[model samples]
Target: MTAMEQGGTGMAGARRLRQPAARPTWLPPGSIAFCLRSWAAVMLALGAAFWLQIDSPASAGVTVMILSQPLRGQILSKALYRMAGTLAGAVVAIGLVAAFGQDRIMFLGGVALWLGLCVVLGTLARDFRAYGALLAGYTVAIIGIGCIDRPEDVFTVAIFRVSAIMIGIVSIAIVNDVTGSPTAWHRLAAGLRRGAAEVGQIAHDAVNGRATPDDGAWLDLAARIMALTSQVSFARTELADSALRMTGARSAMVAMLDMISCSRAIGGVLPAGAVRPAILAAVRRRFGDGTPFADEDAARQALNDLLHAAPADAPPTPAEAYLIERTMALLSYGRWVRDGIRTLEEGRAAPRVARDVRIARQQDPVLALLNGAPVMTGFAAAALICVLGGLPGTTTTLLQVATILTLSITTFDTRAFGIGALVGVPLSTVCAMVLDTRILPYGSGLPFLALMLAPVIFAGCLLLIHPRLMPVGLNFGVFFFIVLGLDNVHNYDPTQFVDRNLHYMLSAVILFFALTLAPPSARRRRFRIASAVATTLRRQFIGRGDIASPALISRQYDRLLQARTWTGHLPRKPATLRVFDRIVSLGDLNGALARARRHLARAAAIPAVAGQVARTQAMLRALHGPDAAGRLLDQAAHLLAAAGHLPPADRETLLGAVSGLFGAARLLDRNARALRHYGILPPPEAAP
Candidate 1:
C-alpha cells in the first residue's frame, strides 16, 4: 500500500505506518526489505516446526516476530538473549514443577516468586540484557501455567517451546546474514565520528570562551559512547574485519570523552586572563573555530609552538601549569581521534588508549524489589482469579498477561508497552478473526496458510522495524498471531477463537492495571533514580573516608550518567543541572579523599600528620545535621593545613584533601538546592 493509503487507517494506525526516516537511495527501502525477510523467515520456521510436529508450531512464528530487528547486531544480540532466556526459563520451570507439583497453590506461589526475582534482576541489567531477564521471568509462566493440569508434561512443554524458538532463531539468523543487512561496524564508525565531532566542538568552544559544555549533555553523550562498547562483540560476528574496526572506534570514543573531561577540568581551574585568551586563539586558529580538528599534525604543531612560547620567567603556578598540560593532552587526544578514524577506515587495530575511569552503577535493592511488585502481583491475581472463578483453559491467558508485563518491566517506560498491548492485541485479534472466518478455509495446508498470512505478517514486520512504531507494532503483531493460536491441524472454530481473544483481552486489561496502578511512571522512575544517586553521594561524602572505592564511585558516576541520558529531554535550566553538578562534585571529592588517604597512610609514622588525619576524619563523620556541611568543610580545611610539616609526599596528600574539601564547599554554596538535598543550610531564597 502507498504510505498515504496505509495511513488512512486512523491516527493510531497512521502512527504505526509512518517511517521515522527516509531510506537511503543506494539501499532498497529498508522497511520493505526487512518486512519481506521477516515474513520469509517466519514461514520457514513455521514450516519446520509443523513438519517436525512441535506442539506449538505458531511459537516458531512468534519467535521470528520477536527476533526481527533492523540491524544485524540487534538481531544477533536478541537471538542470543532469546536462547539464554529460554534455556534458563526452561530449567527453572522444570525445577518449579518438580518441587511443588502436588500443590497447585505452592506451585503458583513458587512461580510468582521466581517471576518476581527475574523481574528484579532484569531491571538491574542494561538494554537487551534486561530483556533477557524479563524473558526468563515470564518463560516460567508460559511453561508452568500451561502444564498445571499435568505437571509431568512441563518438561515436554519446555522442550517444545525452546525447540520452536531455536528453529525461528536459526532461520532468521541464516536469512539476515545471507541477506547482507548492514553490519554493526558501520554504525560504530558513525558513532565514533559523531562523538569526536561533538567533543571536538566543545573543546574548541571552551578555548574560545564561546560556551562551556553542558554537564548533562556531556554525560549523556559519554553514556552513549559507553553503551557502544558493549556492541563491539556483536559487530565481530557481522564480519572478520569488524572486530578490529569496532575496537578502534571504541578506543577513539573513550579518548574523545577523556578529552572533554580534561577540558572541563582545566576550565574549572583556569581564570580568564591574557594567557587564557592567547591559548584560546591559538586553539581556535588550529582547530578552526568550533569544527572538528581536520589536521592533527598542524594542530599538534601549533599547540607545541604555543607551549614553547611561554615565558620562562612567568610565575610557575599550579593553575597555569595544569592549563598547559591540558592543552598538550587535548592535542594528544585529537591525534588519537585521527588515528582511530583512520583505523576504522582501513580495518586495522586501533592504537591503545588509556582506559577512562569506568562509570559506576549502584543498584537499590529496594527499587529492584519494587520493580517486581507489578509482575508478581499480576501473576498472583491472574492465578487467583483463574482458580477462584474455576475458569478452564484460561491459564494460558494469564500467562500471556504476565509475559506482557515481564517484557514491559525492564523498559524505562512501561506504560508504552502496556498501552501498546491494549491496542495491538485487540487489533491483531480482529485481523486474525477476518483471516480465519472470511479469507481462509477451515482446513488449509501449511503452504496455503503461509500464502494467505503473508500480507499480515509482512505488514506487522514492517511496523516492527519502524523506529517510532516498534512498541505498538511488535506488541500488536506478535500477540495478534499468538492469540489466534494457529496450528498444523486447523480448528477454525469461531467460538474458540472468540473465547481465546476475550481471555487475551482480559489478560491485557490485568497487565494494563498492574503497570498503570502500581509501578512508577517514566518521570517518577527517573526522579527516584536521580534521588537515589544524590543520596548515595551524600552518604559517601559524610561516611568513612574509605567508603569511596574507585570502583564504587565509578559505579555511582555511571548511574548518574544513565540518569542524565534518561532525562536528556528535560529542560536545561532546573535543579536537575544543579543536582547533577553536585553529584559529580561529590564523586570527585570521594576520589580525591581516597587518593589522599592512601598517601596519608604512607606518612602516618609522623605523629603530626596522623593527628591531622584523625581530626579530618572526625569532622567528616559529624557532617550530618543542617549547617554542618559548611562548618565541617572549614574545619577539615584547617586540619588539612596543619599537616604542612609532614613529609613532602604526605603534605601533597593533605593539599589534595583540602582541594577536594574546597570543591565540595563551593558546590554547596553555588547550588542551594544541592545543599538542601544534603541536609545543609536553607536554600538560597529561603535563607534569612
Candidate 2:
C-alpha cells in the first residue's frame, strides 16, 4: 500500500514544482500605464489629423510615438523642444527652397550642409537640447528635399508638417493630463534623496577609515550622480516653482560631487586609526541615519570640536589636518544636500547657504566633428545615389538616410543604433504589412484602425522601457506609423507597401555601413579623456588651473564620469585599467591644487601665511618626486602652525589651505610612479 502511494505522491510533487508561478504579471503597473497612455495619444493624434484632413495624418501618429515618455514632464519638455526645432527647421527649409528651387542639386547640397551643421551642434549639446538640434537637421530634409519636385508647395508642406506635429503634441498632453501621469519632480526628488544616502554612507566610511571603495566603484557612483543632470532639467518643466526646485537639485548634485572628492581625498591621505575614536564616533552618529543635520550651526560646531580634539601634547599631522578639513567640508556640503532635497520636496526657495550649482558638460570638438562628418558624407552619398538612380521613391530613401544619420548622432553608440534600425525597421515593415493587408483590410472605420494599432504600440512601449531594448523599440515605434503609409484615404496596394519597405530597409543598410565604417571609438575616447585629465593636471601644477569653486568641482566630476563611462565600453585590459587609474589620480591632484589655491586666497591677507603659501605654490609648479612631496608637507605644516594665531573663522580657512597642501603632497607621493610613466610628473633624475 505504501510503495504505490509514495510513487504517485512524488510524481505529483515534481509536476507541481515544474509548473510556473503565475507569471507574476509580466509587465509592471507603470509600464502598462505608459503603454496605454501612448496608445491613447496616438489614437487621439491620428483622429484629429484625419478629421482636419491634414496632408500627413501619419506624421501626427509618429509624433506621438516619438514623444512617448513615462513622465508627463519629459513629454512636455521634449514636445516644447520638438515644436521649436520643427518651426526653426521649417523656416530654414523655406529659405533654402526659395534660393535653390530651380537647382535640385544645389538644394540637396544645401540641405546636407545644414544637416551637418546641426549634427555638430547636436553632438555638443546634451539632453533635450541635443534632441532639438537633431530634429532641426532632419526637419529640413523632410521639408526641403521632400519638395524637390514640388518646390512651389514647400510652404504648404511646412505648414502641414507643423500642423500635424502640433496635433500630436496636444494629443499627448491631453492624454497625459487625463491619465494623471507621474511627474519628473517626484521621481527626481526620490532619486536625489537616495543618492544623498548612498553618498553619505561613502563619506562616513571614508572618514571612519573603513574599507574604501575601488576606483571603478567611485566612478560608477559619480556617473549615477551625474545622470541626474538630465532629470533636473526635465523636472524644471514640472512645477511653477521649478526654478527654486532646480536650484536645490543643482546644489545637491554639486554637494554630492564635493562629498565624493573629499571622501576620495580623505581616504587617500588619512591612514587607518589616524582620527581620534571620539571624532570617528561623532561622524558615524551624524551620518548614521543618512539624513541632513537638524541644525547646521550645531553640526558645524560639532565638526569644529572634532577638528580641535587632537591632544595638545601631539600636534596634528598632515593626514590629521586634511581629515579635519575634509570633515568640515562634509558638514557644509551635507547641509546643502539636505536643503536641496527639502526644496525639491516642498517646492520652496532653497536656503541662502545653498549656492546655485551648474554641472558642466565636456565637449570634444574632435568627437563632434567625427560624429558630424560621417553623417554629412553618408547623407550626401545617399542623396547622390537616390538622385542619380532616379528610382520612383528615391526622395523617400534619401529622407530616411538623412533622418537616420541625424538621429544616430544623438546616441553614444552609433553601431547599436544602426543595429537597432537594421532589426527594427524591417520588423516594423512586416508588422505594418500584416496590419495593412491582413488586419486592417478585414476591418473598417477609426475604431477598427485604433484597435489594430493598440497591440503594436503596446509592444513597442514595453520594449522602450527596457534599457537593452530601447533602441529597437524607439525605431520600431516611430517607423511603424511611417511605414504603415496611413493617409486620408487608405491604399491597400501590395506594390507600394513592398516599395516603401525596400526604401526604408535600404536606408537602414546605409546607416549600418556608415556607422560600421567610422564607429565612435571607445578606446580612442577613453585615451582622449585621459589626455584631457593630464593636460588639466599640467595646468594645475603650473598654478594656471581654475580656482576651486562650485563650477570647477562640477566640471571635474563631469570629466571623470565621462572617462568612467567610456572605460566601461572598452575591453578589460590592464593597460585600460592603468589609464583609468591615472585619470582619477590626475583629477584628484587637480582638485587638490584648486582647493589649495582657494584656501590660500581666503587666507592670503595674512602676510606670514601669504609668503608660505606662495612658496608652496612655487613648489607645486615643479612637483616631481617623493622629495618634493616631503618638502611640500613641511611647508604645509608651517602653514598649519600659523593658523592657530588667527580668529576662529580665519583659523579654519587657513587650516583648509594647509590641509589642501597636505592632501596634494600625499596624492603626489601615492601616484608618483604612474604620474612619471604618464609624463605628468618628472622622474627622479629630471627633478629640479
Q: Tell how far residue 484 is off in model 1, in angstroms.
A: 2.2
Number of clashes found in candidate 2: 0
Candidate 2: residue 470 lDDT (0-100) = 77
Model 2, residue pairs in steric clash = none
Tell me each candidate's RMSD, in Å, in order: 9.2, 9.1
lDDT of 2 by residue, 486-584 (tens): 999988988878977788888888878886677888888877787877887877766677778777777777887888778889888998887776676
Name the candidate that leads on lDDT: 2
The lDDT for every candidate, in the order shown, is 0.65, 0.79
The candidate scoring highest on TM-score is: 2
Using all chains and alpha carbons, the TM-scores for the candidates as numbered come to 0.78, 0.91
